[model samples]
Target chain A: MATSSLLLLLADGRFPAGAHAHSGGLEAAVAAGRVTDLVTLEAFLAGRLATAGLVGAAFAAAAHRAVTSAGSAVRGSTLALLDAELDARTAAPALRTVSRRQGRALLRAGRAIWPEASFDDLPSTPGGAHQPLVLGLLCAAAGLSRAETAAVAAHGTVTGAASAAVRLLGLDPYQVQALLVGLASRCDGTAAEAARAADEPPERLPAAAAPLADIHAEAHATWEVRLFAS
Target chain B: MRAYARLVARADGRGGTVLAELRGETPLLLRQTPGSGRAVTVYVVGGAAGPLAGDDLRLEIDVGPGAAVRVHTVAASVALPGRPDVVSRMAVRAVVHDGGALHWLPEQLVAAAGCAHLAESRVELAAGARLTWRDEVICGRYGEAPGGAVVHTRVDYDGRPLLRQSLAVGPGAPGWAGPAVLGGAPATGSLLVVDPSIPHETAAVEGTLARLPLAGGPATLWTATAADAHTLRDHLDVEVEPLLTKVE
Candidate 1:
């Protein structure tokens, strides 16, 4: 499927979509001396996956499920609900803005290349939809398999953390990659968990624990010398 | 610095609602000893409980799941003396069930001249449960220019925190030092809530916050949602207005 290749492309950290600019609050963690080394980074990433990542996975899966309902008039309503729901769930103003920013970035790129009717009608309202949901639908439209969609998400989260840490803490690329390899199983396990529970209701979907990340994100939003975009 | 304290109340959970109802219900008996003391403690030996006083007070809240409790204080906290490292501390422990609402709002604290106060509150939420908490701190006890007081609050929900808000008046803080950020404003307070349904992708939610009418005062909201926690921070800079009117 096209998604397999697309997944490979998106998984690369070199993608010039500006995704490298955000540490997703990890910058604040580093600034506050909360995430100083690789072990702390691992803990932070794990927490995010359970909390924020879980939410992203659910929305992505939901969006992917709805991608095929093109003629179904409920598409608009479903999308609207997903957008609003995600918006409400994201309490940090900075985080919400970042989500929409990344979503727009993905939408811009996906629309220019894919040019599919599905991508054409993507919402434009401020804080419309998260990038993950957008990318999930885009991947689905590109004929990606379920495994590929899950892999893209897992890769993005890990890479986003690693790249942000590299810029924030200036770590050795080899060390970070080793850390990523070590955490690869956790990401895979999380992704597999998401895939298996895809049938569960959205409200009942599991959320991994990660409150410190939220705290840091709020603190980061008010920082004076912020390095990372998020 | 001695924080004046007074509270005599029915420690009974009698009031159905503190905001809407509680008309005919016996007013929570609250009496206190005033002196602006630091180690002020009012044991819940009597009726309803009230908040600790003083501009420099430390409030610690810890709640275990399924604990039904509510707390409030009588007179508005006063910062009579602001120097000599005067402070107050209030630590809360609560573990509310799936259907408990702890409406904790003691009177706001007034920061007198050069008041550096730190207030921290923490709450942990369980699945299918709700926690409604609203509290405000107004700085500038003497109506100085740019309003006064530097208030800092850190509230957490579960292990995943919901709120971490810090406010500084004219100086000593980051935003007030420059022309941007707060725009050299004064007076700020916030109302924050955290519910289930944490966002997966992003952690900041300003959609519901931006819609708030901050009146004509200097105020801003800070919020974030990740995992099981949600946090909203609101601040107000009071001018020549009554301290009680700006809050509540």
Candidate 2:
């Protein structure tokens, strides 16, 4: 029953964090004809999870650990370094913005339930309370391990894609939930890998690979018909 | 020579690559400077902008938590009129800490005749942070006889590969005048914006101005993989709007 509650908490799409408004780049993919069905969508989702999603998870884990170990007052440069790196890799204008929006929403939600993120308590000058930063802060408060923090990051990412799928393919919500459940292990594995490497110095970062995705994102920006915002 | 970026929370340059930390509360302090050193040396600074001479151009930025720093160029970058020397590569990098947002928006790049330039930009996102921006690379003289030009650009984001663009335009290059990368065209430009908050209808978000006018140009947009992440790609086939034509 406890596990079911956690699953429900992670699975509920209507939790009001604004996950319904974004298709990430799937909507643009659909308009551009790059994604037409579930198979391609799955491939795309898997590919992203392995790349951007993996990176996000790793950073979230590191950040969660940073908050707990480095004390509550962390340096701003640490987060900015991650943000810049994320920006450098995000080729699509839509996805970059989408991630921040979701990140922000997550932060907002975190404050109410998990006060460690302390959204209402942060210094107002630092408007850059990005989603991952908030996630890390909240995870610390939740008493979650480093691996669990990474999993949360991965879960949020899948949720973004699954939400987009419902609108793009009109797939049944139950099916999406089931697919998510089945794929949980894969996401967890990714989280574990991310947590394992969370302690690496920022200088020795890995290389990102997503060309078709970037070209599509740029082209999509020039489009005249898109269903989702990003 | 390849330029290596050193990570520093704060760098102050009185006139060049140096900068002073912001003494106030906000972490971000952005300043713009015109062309310097007859070359381009652009970097992020804390609070002020500098000038560009025949040698260098610099930017210093210090982004504090929740603070936003923006460094914009007053005009498009012009690679000196006449040049014949080793590759004049422009390298730019940034160190965005937690709770800090940096927007690097430089004007369009204008590569005139006889210009050999290699531009490189690298960024790393720590975690739970955000970055929104665009970059446009232009080749050839905007308003003069097209000249032989060469551009080799490599852009990377995060730990993955983002963009690897190699373009060579000369009289003898293969398919120089064919319907390929540039569609047998003389002058071409590319724009990339990595922001997710654009609009729900991202495909429809493109405006008429986003297109280039040409009698028979190919214009299209799609999502492809780059640096292990999905990227949106757009192609404007040398076709400028009929009403607004490119004069050379």
Candidate 3:
């Protein structure tokens, strides 16, 4: 598979990874009246991109590096360390569950598509592997570079929430796509930075946090009827 | 200016806690309020003026096995502007040995306008150790825009990472007060409790507050944002009271 085409395929939203079920915290943000329209949605997405996007991308890139560079004997431990570190970075339990659920979903898809991939190396945590780690491992299996893995991770962070915003707020889809286009360069920049930082140790990776989002996610999990899982 | 303060709490063997070692510098003053209880209470009194820019201050705390220590501050520490291009830093490093407990409940930190400040706290816990760590930040003084401020916190339990997060706000940090971050709230804080005795559960979000149990261990983190410090503290106290009482 050509690396560029493979990157596009994995980055596509229809890749059957279970990401569509989660809103990335947009449902709660909308309920709080913090995100009512496209203008506020743009601000929300930007903030999410700068913090969560950057952190997720960095971890995904780092995971990719671990799978590509580490020896087979040490790969499991390295991936476990990455998973634990990422868990530490995620303060909210609901968000953690969502990430792992997505990871489990992605793993199921990866196993069927690339049966020979190193999916066995994923840490067998109670919930499952973290989504970013799974993405990194799958990207590596598809012969994608660290930078491309970061880009996929970064893109998902915003697109998931943006798509949710359209559903939750009934905003114009064209405007939302335009908003995403405006953010394309920033998405690329964040991915590049995340890829560069992937060389650092897992403990030293980006741990940027959004306190409001953490609070929102916890609350969202409690609602009786919510549009998104997280 | 640079200052490093230290405090050590030890079990007295008579079912009480005592300060085994106490040392303070110019601004990071350590004072023990007289009390006869299982937990030795210490108040961090400000002995000097400001932790102005270019100042580096550190506080070290050690809780010996079976000892309990509670730390408090006399008043809020205001990070004032000082020399240009220099950043003010306050670091707190703590360790709790086996069967020990540490309650770090300091006053809010005011990030005064025009100041560049960095506050960091790292706590390590041995097996069976418990901790209640709280950190609050007031963005700026009244009628003033906040300067650059960053708070980094990391907690390790039994030699493994439990929570590691850094929140940056005010100047130089874009979109910090946006919908995804603080969401225009001026006051923000977090309460973390690491006690194995407490049942594992996640609390529902109440207004601007929410509690989440960490996935790796028996720990819960409650985060809140409000229009003012008093309200933020109240929101945190509501969630913290039940757990603390149950643990005690």
Higher-scoring candidate on TM-score, 1 or 3: 3
User: What local distance difference test score does each model get?
Assistant: 0.49, 0.47, 0.90
* DockQ metric for all predictions: 0.04, 0.04, 0.75
Q: Which ten residues in a row have the lowest lDDT in candidate 3 chain B?
A: B239-248
Give each model a TM-score. 0.53, 0.48, 0.95
For this target, which candidate reaches the highest TM-score against the unseen true structure?
3
| Residue A169 displacement (Å), model 3 | 1.6
Model 3 residue A30 lDDT score: 94
Off by over 4 Å in 1: A1-3, A69-71, A206-209, B1-248
Best candidate (score: lDDT)? 3
| C-alpha DockQ for predicted model 2 | 0.04
Better of 1 and 3 by DockQ: 3
Ranking by TM-score: 3, 1, 2
Models, CA RMSD each:
14.6, 14.9, 1.8
Summarize candidate 3's per-residue lDDT along B64-93 as a digit string, tens digits: 999998899999988889999999999999
TM-score of chain B of each: 0.49, 0.50, 0.96
**Number of backbone collisions per candidate:** 77, 126, 0
Model 3 stretches with alpha carbons more than 4 Å out: B239-248
Tens digit of lDDT per residue, candidate 1, span A108-217? 77777777548644556665567867877777777775556666776677679777888788888889889878778877776776655555644334432232444455
